[model samples]
Target: MSHPDTLIAEDLLLLLMDDEKGRLSASSQAQPLLGGALLVQLALDGAVEVEETNSRWRPAKVEARQVAGTDPDPLLAGAWETVAQKPRSAQDLVSRLGKGVREQLQDRLVAKGMLERRQTRVLGLFPSTVWPAADRQHEQQVRQRLQDCLVAGAAPDARTAALVALLAAVDQAHKVVDRGALSTGEVKRRAKAISEGAWAAKAVRDAVAASQAAITAAVMASTAATVSAGS
Candidate 1:
């Protein structure tokens, strides 16, 4: 891809970031979405594929498998190699993929003077951090592209379409766009078409489904953790 820095994960995070507030909006979904984005990126690079598994005892699970040679991008290569080391279910793999990944990516962007770090707390007690935009132009472009594709019905190339699919599957797409731009019905219709469109690979679809379950589980698990902590 000509724009290697234009990672789908970064775009999603950028769009989620509240520049004026210096906090990522809907912080709960950030890591799960980032994890999903990484997997989707690996799939798009042809370095990984996901296998479906249906079980009554658990949430949706899928196996991540390597597809080809080493990816030239170190971040991609590192994650690719980690997946190669073991066969992991989507939730387990996402846990690994997302652990500290936000910090790593943010550090890279910060080093380039593109992002700024700020600290806050969840529920006014749990300390948390946010990466606000040090440079807003690039992220604005990313958000605009998403708006054009989902609202205006413009055709996006593969990578972008994959980002939309991953975000939508996790029920986070609406968080990034201007709702007034398109009716809820139009938004859903367009997002579904892009996500399930011909440009999306079978592996991407499976990964997204698996990640959706993983995201739900993560949200529930974190909420439980918070409750248990309070108790």
Candidate 2:
């Protein structure tokens, strides 16, 4: 059976308090309560109220200074009084109190068990479609399956063919070296031979010269582009 839609009274209270203070400044538990967008909305709508804790003292207006040294509970009462007068948005609250103090207050609220969280299907802003909801267990299973597949193979099906082509190219390069089979002394002799027969080594000489010309041209082009862009 699906759970019924419920709003935590503490969360609504905190959001209302944050609205009044222009930021959150409660215990750690209150942080999560302030995070809920729905709770914020309810506080703005004036659907929630802060219950008076002490029966003996029923003052019309509770000053901030009065609850200065007391615990967060009493401060919450004062906050409710202030929020009840004027409803404000979360953004307005943050703007008034500053981000740092607002976040600290949220943390304090969350640390206490007074705040509660519930799941709700909120509408998507951009896509205009309901997001598929999955339970915690289903999400864990999906992650585990994806991890298992990755560990079994280095490359996925689509990339397997490309990997084979790369391996073949490496094998061909190795074959070329094997066919040349020149000893250390032979390699030195070949170098000397090339120097002696410079005209006969025209093919190798032209390749080296072409590479140097391309590099120089590329550097000149890049410099010209940089200068033009700057200007």
The clash numbers for all candidates, in the given order, read 0, 19
Give candidates' CA RMSD values in order. Answer: 3.7, 32.0
lDDT of 2 by residue, 27-139 (tens): 23233223322222222223232232345444221111222232333333434444455544332231222223334433444454323232333353343211122122322
lDDT of 1 by residue, 106-127 (tens): 7777776778877899899999
TM-score (C-alpha, index-matched) for candidate 2:
0.18
Q: What is the TM-score of each candidate against the true structure?
A: 0.80, 0.18
Residue 93 miss distance in model 2 (angstroms): 3.8
Please report, as a residue range, the 10-residue window in candidate 2 with the lowest summed lDDT. 167-176
The local lDDT score (0 to 100) that residue 62 gets in candidate 2 is 14
